[model samples]
Target: MTQSTANFKVGNEKLIKVLDGASSHLRGLLEKQGRPDGALRIAVIGGGCSGLQYKMDLVDGPRDRDILVPSNAVNVVIDPKSALFVSGSELDYSDDLQQGGFKVTNPNAVVTCSCGESFSA
Candidate 1:
């Protein structure tokens, strides 16, 4: 894990809650990818059907000015800007044949796309 030189506090496990399913899946993915020490990065990006979408990636660790949250024994990192959109959100996973993937339930979102891949806050 890369250490940030900044001194500001970034620990906020409550920012986005990671459900059991999501945590388990993320841990497995990190292990398979040979990055058990890595963290999951969640960001809000524009250009989705609803004007906003979520982008996730497995990263080595939190960067400078990044918020590092620990939930369900998993580490999740978010940039300062992306934190605004994902605050008070919940991340979950599903193994259903049709909707099998990670999903974020954001309380700030007022409208979500029918595909469940985008939202408007």
Candidate 2:
């Protein structure tokens, strides 16, 4: 369960990067949930106003077809199907007054909702 950030590359391409704030937040959640070895799973599911929604959760391990991206002290797990939409995105954490939570800055998104929870590629 110990991985370095430099090991997050997929072939010759770099996968998503998790900012320090997001990694800290996720690590705290895993500790609180008593799953220090758990990983954060990010997936794209059909729903939301933009037709595709990003779903995230803490899981004990990666599922079949998952791409493991390590960042700092946390590991981000994304399924292959979801990776198509989230590739090159940054997993960030924000505490701004307007919006405060985990956010995805996706370059592939054609349109993203104001809430930052859903998008279309």
Candidate 3:
């Protein structure tokens, strides 16, 4: 993985708290899922019901174009391609069963679904 000089900051208190919680959950899931060296990867991809969708997973390796951010003892990797769509966005986790799990709040999203899973930028 090529580390760029781009010192991206994972700001926002609520976002950080959410990321920390998500990191804890992800770490446990990864351990249970069985990959000691893996990390939680988040990306924006095309072709959802909307124009774009958020994609996340536990990945063991980083590609050349991935932008890396560290949060709560975990490495958060965002692909360079996806960064264009997700830049200036905040990641948050909701414990509410009705809207549980991680959620991405993108300032760049021109349109977003009620569930906040899909968007049009």
Candidate 4:
């Protein structure tokens, strides 16, 4: 199936809510850093014990083949390789005292480690 064909049981409204929440925090961070030019890139790499890991970084430039997912306020870029692993993923930001920040909810995951940083495909 195509990358976009991956099904997300979550409703669009809810997905947008989560995306919006993430955008807000990212934008805030960029603003505090003086509004650099570029997008926040999210990627899943192979390294963690579970064999896959999630990572986020601010990229001032995007190479060709980067997938762009734009919200009303933010643009999220993911490399094609990573796109395959996170096709149906939703990124959300949490500010809870215990655990917080950009949390990726990936339906493609078969299992995730307790730290929520690694997963099995």
Query: Lowest summed-lDDT stretch of 10 residues in model 1?
Result: 3-12
| The candidate that achieves the highest lDDT relative to the unseen native structure | 1
Task: Give per-candidate clash totals.
Answer: 0, 0, 0, 0
Q: List the residue pairs that clash in candidate 2.
A: none
lDDT of 3 by residue, 1-121 (tens): 9955544444323232225667677778778878866766787888677789998988874666566666666667777677778777767677888979888888888998888899999
Error of 3 at 62 (Å): 1.0
* lDDT (Cα) of model 1: 0.88
Better of 1 and 2 by lDDT: 1
- Cα error, residue 85 of model 2, in Å, equals 0.5
Better of 1 and 2 by TM-score: 1
Candidate 3 lDDT at 76 equals 70
Better model by TM-score: candidate 3 vs candidate 4:
4
Report the Cα RMSD per candidate.
Answer: 2.4, 5.1, 5.0, 8.0
Q: Candidate 2: RMSD over Cα atoms? A: 5.1
Off by over 4 Å in 3: 1-18
lDDT of the candidates, in the order given:
0.88, 0.83, 0.72, 0.71
Ranking of models by lDDT: 1, 2, 3, 4
lDDT of 2 at 23: 88
**Candidate 1: C-alpha RMSD after superposition:** 2.4
